[model samples]
Structures are given as C-alpha cells and as structure tokens.
Target: MALVIEGEERISAPVDKVWAALNDPAVLKEAIPGCQKLEMKSPTEMAATVVLKIGPIKATFQGEVTLKNLNPPNGYTIEGEGKGGIAGFAKGGADVTLAADGDNATILKYAAKADVGGKIAQLGSRLIESTSKKLAGQFFSTFGEKVGG
Candidate 1:
C-alpha cells in the first residue's frame, strides 16, 4: 500500500524549544504513543520497537529511524523502515517544518508518505488512512503536552 498523510501541529513553545524536543531521543520516546522502546544508535539514528493495534490486528514493529536534512529551528526529515514478521514490512518518511509564531509559539507542519507490502497492504486503504490519522494525532497531542509542560 502507498499512503500519504499531511498534518500540522501548533506547539506552545519557541521554535528552538520545539526543535530541541524533536532532536531529543528522550522527548521522542515520551511523545510517541505505543512506542515500546527507543534507543539512540547515533547522533542521527535510532532503533525502536513500537506496538501498533488497528482494529482487529495488532503487531510489533522493529525499525530503524533516521533524521536528516536538518535546518536548525526550521525543518527536518525522518525516514524509517520496519519489519513486522509475517505481516511484511513498511517504509516511510516525513518532512517536518517548524515556523515561529512569536517568542513562545511555533507551528509544526508535517507531510508523510508510506508504503506497506505483503499482507499489510491487504488491509485496505480506509483502514490504513484512519489508523494513520489516529496515530498522528496521538503523537502530536502527547508531544504538545510534553512541550507545553
């Protein structure tokens, strides 16, 4: 399956603060809902395990995530690939942009694209779209709360 999703999140923090939050592995571990483990493998790389449940299916995905195309306090892109055992695999990337609203506010915009193969693709587009949106919302909501505090 080939899927695309776009979303924006307004954060109650400065661009620099938000950028710091984005780069910090600890912050990401806290913000990513359903994430079981997140380990920093290098400055720009991480290994993670996430358990995702959509409707009647539940799977654990082990993946490597990389951050690149960095422009401090502005934008960056992240790419990841996950293996889900018999469920097949998934690969995706997201471009995240941050714009300062004032001294203590920022707008975060993200455009994401993903592809799933094998059994995962058989799940149908509607299910995939809904699950993606829910996951995105969960991530941003948790991120905003963490950043706001």
Candidate 2:
C-alpha cells in the first residue's frame, strides 16, 4: 500500500539553526521515534536501524537514508528504504522546505510518500496511516524542542 502525509510546523528557532539540526544525525536520532541507530556514511547518506509498531505488528527496520536536492539552509528531499524481514519492506521520501517565520522562528513543511508491502501491509490502511502520522508528529515535536530550546 501507499501512503501520503503532509504537515507544517512552526519552530521557535532561526531558520539556520533549524537547518543545522535537520542535517545532524545526533539530532535526528533523538527525534526519530524508536531509532536505535543512525550513523552518517557520507555527507548525504546515512545508515539507520529503527523499530516501529503499526497496530498489532512490530518490526525492526535497517535502512539507508539519502539526502538529495540540497539547497543549503532551505531544505532537501530525504529518501529511505528499509527491510523488516517477515514484516516486509518500506520505501519513502519526503520533500522538506524551511521558511523563515521571523529572525528567530521558522516554518518547516514536509510532504511525504511511502509504500509498504508484506505482513505489515496486511494491517490495513487506516491503522498504518494513523501510526505513520503519529510517528511523524512525534519526530517534529521532539525536534522542535531540541532545536528551539
């Protein structure tokens, strides 16, 4: 199945700072829900291990994350693909954009698309979509706090 999610957040921090936090693995690891490991392989590439639960299904995903279409302190596209063994696989990408709300605040926006298959997809779309939205909310809320304060 395929899923699409989009949202915007107002971060109480400068755009430059938000941009820096977005590219930092340490920050991402903390913000990402259930992220066990996140390590940079190159300037635009990372290796990750994350545990996720959707409805009655839970899985550990090992994946490669790549950053593309870099535009400096503006935004970029983040793409990732992971294998979860019997749970199945997931591949997705998000187009993120950052705009200055003010000298000390930024508006972060993202539109994401994802596809899942195998056992996880068997859970149905509603459960998967809600779970995905919750995860995304958690990440940004944590990230905003970390970056803003």
Best by TM-score: 2
lDDT of 1 by residue, 1-149 (tens): 88898999889999999999999988899888788999999989999998887667678889999999989979999999988887778889999999988788999999999888767778888988888878877888789889977
> Candidate 1 has which clashing residue pairs, if any?
none
Q: Which stretches of candidate 1 lie over 4 Å from their true place?
A: none
- Give the worst 10-residue stretch by lDDT in candidate 1: 50-59
- Decoy 2 TM-score against native: 0.98
TM-score, each model? Answer: 0.96, 0.98
**What TM-score quantifies how close candidate 1 is to the native fold?**
0.96
Model 2, 1-149: lDDT tens digits are 99999998899999999999999999999999999999999999999999998887889999999999999899999999999999999999999999999699999999999999999999999998898889888998899999998
Flag regions of model 2 displaced more than 4 Å. none
Candidate 1 Cα lDDT to native = 0.87
